[model samples]
Each structure stands twice: as structure tokens, then as C-alpha cells.
Target chain A: MTINEIQDELIADFAFFDDWMAKYEYIIQLGKELPLIDAQYKKDEYLIKGCQSKVWLHADYRDGRVIFTADSDAIITKGLVGLMVRVLSNHSPQEIANSELYFVDQIGLKEHLSPTRANGLLSMIKQMKLYAITLQAKTT
Target chain B: MMEKTAVLEQFDVYGIRKDFPILTRTVNGKPLVYLDNGATTQKPLQVIDAIRHYYTELNSNVHRGVHHLSQLATDAFEVTRHQLKGFINAAHDHEIIITKGTTDSINLVASSFGSAFVKTGDEIIISAMEHHSNIVPWQLLCEDRGAVLRVVPINAAGELDMDAYRALLTDRTKLVAITYVSNSLGTVNPVREIIEAAHANGTPVLLDAAQAIQHIAIDVQALDVDFLAFSGHKMYGPTGVGVLYGKEKWLDAMPPYQGGGEMIKEVTFEKTTYNELPFKFEAGTPNIEAGISLAAAIGYIQDIGMDRIAAYEHGLLEYATARLLEIPGIRLIGTAANKSSVLSFLVDGAHPYDVGVILDKLGVAVRTGHHCTQPLMDWYGIPGTVRASIAMYNTREDIDTLAAGVQKAASMLV
Candidate 1:
């Protein structure tokens, strides 16, 4: 599925929740199901800065597509990381880089991505795009 | 015990809550349960009104100009210094130096006092439980002067190891800067004992009273502490204003922190002589509004009486500790015998930030993460703990709400 299709699916899924607690409960469940990153890549070199919680991200380029994996010490941040991975992973670098993630706001999780939140979701998005841009540069 | 209960009953926490307008507000559609007082307290209407009065009536540059507004502003600004001198019971009003805040005050002492006294091969003593504000300045001073920095270790209960601290205090010790109360742990240190131990070696001690000044009644003369620093915001005053109360001898001897208009006797091309005590440290056009407004905060506290305030907060702390302990998977950090109002804790196998976020959704505002005491966090071998620090306005109901929030968070996260 394309990034926009995945985001739309997420927004629709979140719309079913009646209250903030229900939405957060779903996110917390998603946090438990996040795809674990390679243990070797979980060092300071890959650690994203500016987060109150520690987050590590790694990218791999294969079959002319960029695959992304991430992890966070915080469950909520991990859940957000899971969403980012679902939307952006296994896509062409240009497609990934150009993707506009509006579903975050639609799903009532926009606050988690704010710079002031310090949860690293915004930084995670930036890091993912930077990876895509760099990988796209290598082919040219 | 009966007398204590009587004082707590007379305290009237709900009445005090009305004075703070922010207490009436809500967060996330629930009544705001503000437990982040250790970070910065909500200002009373008195303090807020004083700020409005300063701008509306006496908005003029202080310590200058031959106008009525200037005189009013100057008089108001100086009144805070006098109030602070009485509030902390400093030896002289001139000993109160208006600073940016506690961090700025600590940096002032570190820079000026370090330059005057600290030298190469000298040692400065600080404790493990100090906030980064109290720790970083001394580290910078030590780094600049080629001096060594020594730390007093804390026990598992987060209490300072007095035996270890005494052993660390040696002839090489140039200064001892420690916090009177731990912001993260809520451990009230034996500051009088700590001061006496340092004084035995003729070393001047600087007490970071940013946490203590609001909770405890401090008499600098009685404590015989050479330097005491605190911020106004923590005590229900406006931000950007703090007080540094130094002994007359030290204030007289130390070089000026910042060379500027008010801090200097006179400026010349050749050499500029510094001004007298308090003014020598206050360099620029000060935080005039906050300086004046701080007097209102003091008046608010004094009118209620510090003894009554302490008794009320102690009751809240006891009630909170008991309520929170009933929740399963709860681990209370800083289990010191004596503590102020801070309650730092963690749920089993749950991150502090996640718990904090959950609590926020429930309209319970708590401070999460290291509380700027990274070294202490490192010692604990945990990332951080969720800290709910109480203030005078907080009641038993607030504690119940917090306990419920924490229970909900733990059930969700753990």
C-alpha cells in the first residue's frame, strides 16, 4: 500500500475510538507490537537527539526501496514509531521523502509530534526523511 | 499531634487555592491537579496583581531618573530586597542581591567566589542529589580554575552519607556548595550540620535554597551559612527574579560578578571600580516587575504563616505517600526518613515518561524524567521517575486524584 493509503487506514481506525483513553489504549497496544530493531543498531550513533525518551532508528536500502525500523524506551513513543514504520517503510526513497503525514493530526496524536512534546516523533520523522533523501542521493 | 492537626485544620487549603487563579483551571477536560510545584509554582492573585500594578502605575527604569515613577519603581524594587532580608533573616538588607533566578545566583557565586578564593589543586564539595543548576556552575568553576570537584554520595534512601561527606571535607576544600533540599528526592539535608563541618575547615558554604526557602523557614544568621541562594518563582512569585544572601565579609571581598551600570562605582577608560554589596552583583537594569512582585509572594506566605504552611504540606505529603503506596506495582523512590513534599515513584516495568503522559491525559500534571539531576538518576540506574511535588495550595483531594491517576497509568502501562 502507498503511504497515503496507510495513513488513511490509520485515521479511520482511530476514528472508531470514542474517547482519548480508548485511542491511547490502542496506541499502547501498538507499542507492544512494534517491530524490534536490530540489536547491533541500538547504539548512540543511531540514537536520535532532542527526545526526553531515547529513540534509535535504522534504515536499509534494498530492491530500490528504503526499509525503516525504530525503537523507543517509552511505550507511547514506540507506538508512534510503529505508525511511522507502517507508513514509510518498504517504499521508494523519493516516495518516502515526499510523503506528508497528515494522519497524525487527524488521529488526535498531533501533540506527540510537536517539538515541545520532546517524545522524538517529529525528530523520528525528520530522521526517516533524511535517510530517504540520502539513499535517493546514492543512486544518482 | 493534636496541636499539629489543629494547625493543619486552620490552614484552609481550599481558601489558599482561591488565591491562585490557575488552580481553578482545568486540563484535558478535568480539574487540573498541579503536582509540578518543584519545577515552578503557580502565582497567587496577589503576585499577579502586584505585577499588573507595577506596569500600570510604576513602569519606570529603577535606580535612575529624577521622576515620580522612577522613585516609585525604585522604592518598590528595594522593598522586595528588604522583605527578602526579613523573610530569610539575613544580617543586612544590603546582603540581598537581586539575580535572574537560583541558577543565575549559583553561577554568580561560582564565578565571583571562585575567582576570589578557589585556585588550582583546590577542591569543591557537592552532593549526588543536587539539581543540574547547583551542580553545573561548580563544575564550570572547577574546570576553569584547574580545581577538583568532589561529590558526597547518597544512600539508597536518597539521604546524604554524612560520614562520607565529612571525610570528603579536607584542607584542600575551598568551598562546599550543596542543596538544602533535594528537588528530585525531597530529602531535607542536615544543612546546619553540613555548614558546621565545612566551617570547621574555615571553608565557606553556599546552600542552594531554591527548594528549601519556600518550604522551610531560613535564618541565614542562625544557620551561619556564608551564601544562600533561592528563586522567587518556586515560592509563588514571578519568574526572572531571585535572591542571593551572602555574608557581609564575603560580599565585600568577592569581585563583582558582572561589570555593568549598577554594579560599578564608576566607569573609566583606565579602570572601573565596582559598587557596594548587592549592587556589585546586580549589574544591569534588573527584573524590576518581578523584583517588586516577589514582595507580594512573601507577604502572601507571611500572612498565612510559614509554620502553618509547613504543617499543611506535611499532611498532604503523608496522605499522598499512603495513598500511592496502596497501588500495586508502585515503587517509591527516595524513601528518606525526613522529606519535604516531593513524591518520586515508578511503576513496575513502565517508563516514567509514559506514566507522565498517561497522568497528563487524566489532568494530573507531574514532572517526569531526571528532574535535572542526571548524576542521581545514573546512580539509581533508572532513566527517571515521575515526581509529584506538592505546594501549600495542594490538598488531600489533589493527592487522591493523583493516586487514582497513577493507578490508572500503572494499570495501562505496567
Candidate 2:
């Protein structure tokens, strides 16, 4: 799916929840269901810095597209990672780099997320884009 | 609703709360319930005014001036030294050395004491539950001098293992630095027994009282501790000011930590001679405003009476502990038999950061993370805990909010 299409679907999915509690419950469920990264990819080299909880992210660039995998010790952080991977994974590296990611604001996730977590989300996105840029160089 | 115990009702918490203006502010549309006292207590109006009063009226350098303003500033600044001498019950005013904070004080001792006494093969013992402030200084000292750093272990309940500590203390040990109370765990160490045991080995002890000086009454003479360090901001005071109380003989024996203008008796291209007692240690023109306000903070705590404050906070701790345990998934860390007013816990299904976030929305401020004691977290095999530490002005109602907030958080997360 297109990044916008995926974000729209996410917004619609979140809208089904009536309250913050329900939304968080849904996120926790997503965290439980997330495809965790492989143990080898969970090394410090793939670890994303600036997260209060330890988060490991790995990217595979194949057929000019990037597939991102990640994991976190914190369930909420893991859930947030799942949301990020769903939106940007299986997309072209250039498309991932240029993605606006308005879904975060549209879903009101940034507003609800704590300041530190919000910063962590930004860091996650920046790291993903940097990975995409590095891989897009190899493609060229 | 939480029922206030009669013992707690004796304290004029309402009257006391009014002195702190920050308590009046709101967080996330609800009345602020600050439970992060272990991190740093909110500043009081008395301390605020004292800072302003210093800048407005008495703004001049201390000790070296023959001018009128200098004399006024010097007297007010020295008044805090005397107040701290009484606050910690040090034998003399010269025993107190002013520093930037608890970290700076510990660093000062580690550098000076390590140079004077610690040898290449000597050992310095510390405890497991110590804050990073107490642990890192000794580690750095050991690294610099090629000395060995030995740590005394703690049990699952967060109490220091006295037997392990006794075994670690040997004649080759130069210093035994440990926290009087654990900042993250709230476990009050048996400092007296520890001090006595170390003294038998002729090792000087330094108590990191940063977390204890505000909650408990300390008599340095009675404790016979060679050194004690604490910060002003942790006890309703301004920041950037702290005291390191050392016995006179030790201060006389140790080399100066810094070389600056005020700390010297004579300086020449040929050589420099150091000054005496406290002045020998206090290097530059210190935090003038913070120094003057430290007296106000000490006086405010003194007027309220430490015993009454300790009793009231003890009640809050007990109430909070009971209330938190009543929740289904709550598991409290640091279940020390003799604990201070610190409550560090975790919900079975929720991360501490997520719990802290939900609590903040409910206007309950708590500290969540390793709390600068990653070693302690590793000891417990947990990443961190949500700590709700209480002060004298905290009421039973605050804990009720915290408990209810945690329940709400758990329900949402689970």
C-alpha cells in the first residue's frame, strides 16, 4: 500500500477505539502481535539510540524497496515501532525518505505520546530515513 | 478517599504547603500531585525570596572584601555555613566545605583524599545501593591511582549485606564511601554499624546524605562519620549549593581539591601556599545567591521540626504502600524493613514509562527509569521502577490519587 493509504487505514483503525484506554489497549495488542526482529539484528550496531527503552531496528533493502524490522523491551515502544514498520516497510527507499508521515499528527498520537516518547518517535523516523538513504545510494 | 492518620493530622501540612508556590500549579488540567521528591523537592517561597533578597540587597563577594556590601554578603553567606553546621551537628563551622552539589562534593573528596591516602594497591569499599554520585567518584579515584574498588552487595530487599561489607573492610582499605539512604530504593543503610566496622580497620567513611539529610535528622558527631555530603535543593532549598562535612583533622590532612584565588594564602611565580580549614577548599567566588538561600532552606526545615516532618512522611509512606499493594498487579520494589518515605513499584502488565505517562495525565508526577542506579536495577533484574517519594507536605490524598491513577493506567495497558 501507499504510505498515505497505510496511514489512512491506521487512522481509521485507531478511530474505532472510543477512548485513550481503548487505543492503548489496541496498541498493546499490536505490540504482542508484532513480528519481532531476529536475535542477530538485535545487536548494539542495529540499536536506535536516544530511546529510554532499548529498541533495535534493522532494514533489508531488496528489489529497490526497504523492509524494516524492529523490537523494544517496552510494550508501548514496541507498539509504536509496529505502527512505524507497517507504514514505511515494503516501500521504495526514495519514497520512504520523502514520506511526510502526517498519520502521526492525524491520529493525534504525537499529542498523546509523552514528550520523551515523542522525541523517540522522531529519532526512530530519522534513523529509518538515514537507513533508506544509505541503501538508496547502493541502488544508484 | 484516604483517611489521614491522627499522627499525620498533627502536622500543619496545609500551612506547610502554602510556603511552596509551585504546589499551587496545575498539570494536565488536574491539581498537581508531586511525588518525585526523591529526584528533587519543589522550591519554597522562602528560598525563592532569599535568592531575590541576595541579588537585590546583598550582592557582593564573600570573605576577601573590606567594603560594606561585601561584609553584608559575607555575613549572610557565612550564616548558612553555621546553619549547616547545626543542621548536620558538625563540631565546628570549619568542618563544612561548600561545593556545587552532592556530585561535586564527592568528586572533591575522591580527588583530594585519593591523592593524600590511597595507594596503588589500596582498596576502597562502597555498597550496591549507592547512587551514581557515591559510586562513580570512588571508581574514578581507583582508576586514577591504580587502587582497587570493592563493592558491598545488597540483598533482594535492597538492604546492604552487613556481613559482606564487614568482609570487604580490611586494613588496606583507605575509604568506605556509601549512601546513608538509597535514592532509588529508599533503603536506609545501617550507617552507624558500618562506620564502626570501618573505623576498626582505620578506614575513614564518607556518607552520601543527599537523600537522607532532608528526611532524617543527622548528628555527625554522634554518628562519628569522618565525612558527610548533601545538597540544598533536595531539602526545599535553591540549587547549585551543597555541603561536605568532614572532621577537622581530615580536612587538615587532605590536599586541596582545586587551585584558585580564594583558596590560597599566598601565590607567586615561585610557589603557592594554601589557606586554612574551609577556606582552603572553597575555591572560587561560590554560588553567592545559592549560598545565602541555603540558610533559608535549613531554617524552614528547622522551624517545621525534623522529627514531626519525619513522622508525617512516615505515615504517608505507610499509607501509600498499603494503597499501592491493594491494586491487583502492583509489585513494589525495595521492601526494606526500615525504609524511608520512598515507594518504587511496577505494575505487572505495564511498563514503568507508560505508567508514568498515564499518571502525569492524572496530575501525579512520578520518577520512572533506572533513576541513575542502573546497577541496582541490574541487581533486581528489572529495567527500572516507578518511584513515588513523599515529603512532609504530601498528604494521604496524594497517594490515593497515585493508586487510583495506577489502577486506571493498568486497566488501560492490560
Question: What interface root-mean-square deviation (Å) does model 1 yield?
Answer: 1.1
- How does each model score on lDDT? 0.92, 0.88
lDDT tens digits by residue: candidate 2, A1-140: 79989999999988888766677777778888886799899888987754357678889878778989988777777888899999999999888988888887877677534455532556777889998887778777
- Minimum summed lDDT over a 10-residue window in model 2 chain B is located at B1-10
CAPRI tier for the interface of model 2: acceptable
How badly does each model clash, as a count of residue pairs?
0, 0
RMSD of each: 1.1, 2.7
- Number of the predicted model whose TM-score against the real structure is largest: 1
Clashing pairs in 2: none
Best by lDDT: 1
State the lDDT of candidate 2 residue by residue for B210-268, as single tens digits.
98999999999999999999998899988899989999999999999999968999999
Q: How many backbone clashes does candidate 1 have?
A: 0
Model 1 spans with C-alpha error above 4 angstroms = none
Which residue pairs show collisions in model 1? none
